[model samples]
Target: MKSIVTADGYHVPVLLRESVDGMNITPESVCIDVTFGGGGHSREILSRLGNNGHLYGFDQDMDAIDNLPEDAKFTFVRSNFRYLKNFMRYYDEDSADAILADLGVSSHHFDDSNRGFSFRFEESLLDMRMNSKHSKTAAKILNEYQEERLADVLYLYGEIKQSRRIAASIVNRRKTKSFKTVSDLLEVLEPFTGKAKEKKILAQAFQALRIEVNEEMEALKEMLTQALDILKPKGRLVVITYHSLEDRLVKNFFKTGNFEGKADKDFYGNLNTPFKLVNNKVIIPSEEELVINPRSRSAKLRIAEKL
Candidate 1:
């Protein structure tokens, strides 16, 4: 399957066919693509929909506006997916047959040096907000957060074992000169970025700051909870996660209807859940897909149906 590309090549959808196929679209089924970065998945969903079927594409990034498909069956919601329920209510949509979310950062973001999503752009300011209007930025978090809080962000979000030491270093260094640019933070992280794992450590540190700035985990939780409410019985929930943090939440939610991954048992020992797992095992990008879109190496697809 060839990767789908938008006019500006905003993103090449990862697990393109597999993710959309998991939706099990019907000609008249209404669907929602909550992460409409490049409209790759939404476009595919629209293609499968009949005239009566409607698809709502949600995105907070201003860049996504240019990629919107001009079709009567599609509506673009210019808001974060965390407010999925609120927007659905505002639009008078009671339920949807399918919902898809691709939780990876778009290629456009990483490729755009000004976004500061990639560590390679040392000259750029650390402004990693997906929605530029948001008040919080990576620079603010690095400069403002206390040592303990900063450590927690890196430890939990980035899974950096030396987070406390790193945070302390950052706090000590910022006393004289506050962090402003990617290079500022990079200088503080110098000790940790050894030759063998230089790129890996830097990537983790940047990811931590970006996640904190965007409140990604919280938003994902809110969106998933609302998805349960807005999906019709037997409706499908398909998600493509790029990291273990997001994948764990989606996996737990699908299997047990909670983030803790605990299963509730009835008298017959039946595992009670709002959703039935559509894929027992997670789906990863095929070798061919990885060759086509190398950034999709970490992509994992999971699907579930509302019971």
Candidate 2:
């Protein structure tokens, strides 16, 4: 397949060969790339598909539609993968041969400073909506949410130990001025930043806000549930998650075929699961790829097949 990475600097696919190859796609296979950020994986899937095969790429971000490859077999769905079943049914696909989802924010989000996915832009708006059309913004959550609720967002999503302290600081500061820009939030995070692990702490704070703004965990659960329904027997399901929260969900789902991670039991006490883990261990980016793309350092790829 031709390189999808263009001069304009779109996303550079992480774990490219590992992710695409994990799908086990054949010439006649019908596949789906649930988060077609830069069309890298979608393009690779298209290359393996024959004239009779079809590939669907789904993304709620309208900007991603522009990156869609102009191929007859490729169909770009401008919607979240949570609607996977609905779109698959609309297209009359009873089941897909393979399904792939690269979870969390894309490199494009961080690269484009205007998007507010990174802390690099102090004056930028706290608008971290994956789909710009969404109503909620990160600023709103920080300003309007109750202190306890804000603490939960930070503790649960960011996994910060001092979530309560952070939330208290945000609420107290926002009383004087509603947070409108990154600098406004950073000012409150002063005590947390400027330390040896300042970047990590700030990133966590931003991550919690971004995840809440986008409802990412909720969306991932919805999409994963629908994926099982759409995948054919023995079909491959590959997921690349960036954070431990999302990774835990994928790991539990792949193990027990549900989010709770409770293995189902049959009459004979044999475990019954819809999918089996292809890679028993998590796959991380190679040191070489890490050198080339530092953003991929946190990536963890997990592959499973429907039984």
Candidate 3:
């Protein structure tokens, strides 16, 4: 397998083999790789495809392009997978045989101090744009969100029990001065920070901003909507998610086509939803893989077939 990379060039792979194995690829299938960080997973998927098979990849970070292998059967979409429906038109059919997504930040993004994805880098810029051309920045989220709303994001998205204190700290500081980089936020978060504690907090804070900036949750819903409609009957969807929010979204959708799964069924007593779960249980990394790549610890793999 090839190496993993973040859009900014940091290298890490979350769940290397489990994700691809979930795809159930064949020589004749056409595949789409969403969140193509580092192209490690993409290369593995491509290896399974024959010359007649095709691979389509999407990443907002242009840096990921350099890592992509040159191939005639491959197409790369620079836009977010939210537009996956529109972009898939360029392929053999609007529908695909299989779809795979290894979601969340890349190794490159976390490792690059300049990008500031990690609390580990205090001196770095707070600019967490996967696409730098994108207007919203983490700094803006800190500077702009209403205190109550900000607290809600921290509480709900980041799961911070002390979200009130965190929000208060952010708002109070930003009023006196504009926060510029990762270090700026770290100073305010210093009191509550520790290795384990810091990771959860930083991930949550980063998630809220990244979601707002990239419209990630919305994009995911859109992709799910489009995917359910476009995938051929029995076509497979293999997803690897790193956080509970993402996992919850996939779990609900797989179970009920809607995240809440609250829809009422018809007289015939069917699922009222279209998805038929292929892997009824969510898949986790094996002990061996987890030992090698700790990042896979949080990874959750879910699979379903179009119904």
Candidate 4:
């Protein structure tokens, strides 16, 4: 294992051992790490691979791309995980033996003050686009979106109960000047964010913006659907999600191969889904890992296999 703290400190792979162990890697396993942030999970998968084994990693962040390890077995794709199928088809003839995704924002994004991912960084610009190539930023959403739409994002993604009031507050304030920095938005949100729940509210607000900017939910659906198509028979699909929205999606997909959470039945009343649950219960970090990386507390690991 690399030092818990690296020079760049990109991201600590959440549920590292559990996620990879669920993949059931073999000597010649062809693996894909769809959300390779710091390459921690990718490195772990590589260590388990034999000479003929190959690993492909996908990440849109330039910082992650720059930190990719150099090795013949590892191929890094500078693209979002939403394009999983396209890249998978282009690279390997046979379907991947296993696929792993660690969903949500990585540690680096939250830790880096300039990225504007953390509410702690008040002076930082409200630009939470994970991929710089993305056009819309958090600032743009706050400044330009209609009150109803903004409220919808907050309610749906952040699960904020006072989304409407917050939206109204944002629109009223933005009429004077557009929101540009974290502090600018905080000033408007402070009234609603009680002293006891300020951090929680701010985090939810930031998560809503980040999800909107990155199209996280839609992309996740696309990736999950594509993953089902790209995995070989009995191949593993291991995902570690950080929030209920994402966890629910993964759970539903694993159980029924559908986001609607409905499992289709065949003529004989047999389940028609292509996947079978490998782990019925959600997996979380062990006490030891929690002590080492507190951020992993929110991670939920779900493993499924293609039928």
Clashing pairs in 1: none
In lDDT terms, which candidate is top? Answer: 1
Q: Which stretches of candidate 1 lie above 4 Å from their native place?
A: 1-7
TM-score of each: 0.97, 0.96, 0.91, 0.96
Tens-place lDDT per residue, model 1, 48-75, is: 9999999999999999998899999999
- Model 2, residue 224: distance off in Å is 0.5
lDDT of each: 0.91, 0.88, 0.79, 0.89
Candidate 4, after superposition: displacement of residue 135 in Å?
A: 0.9
- The positional error of residue 44 in candidate 4, measured at the CA in angstroms, is 0.8
Tens-digit per-residue lDDT, 1-307, candidate 3: 1124434455555566777877778898888898786777888888899988888998888787787779877788898888888888755467788898887776677777888677788888778888889888888888888999888877877778888998999999998888898778878887876876776676677777666666678889899888887788888898888888888999999988897767658898766777888888888878877666666677788999888
The alpha-carbon deviation from the true structure for residue 67 of candidate 2, after best TM-score superposition, in angstroms, is 1.1
For model 3, the local distance difference test gives: 0.79
Candidate 2 scores a C-alpha RMSD against the true structure in Å of 2.5
For model 3, name the residue pairs that clash: 5-38, 6-108, 10-108
Which 10 residues in a row give candidate 4 its minimum summed lDDT?
1-10
Off by over 4 Å in 2: 1-6
Total backbone collisions, model 3:
3
Q: Which stretches of candidate 3 lie over 4 Å from their true place?
A: 1-12, 90-92, 193-199
Q: Model 4: which residue pairs collide?
A: none
Q: Candidate 3 at residue 66, lDDT?
A: 81
Comparing 3 and 4 on TM-score, the stronger one: 4
Q: Candidate 4 — what's its lDDT? A: 0.89
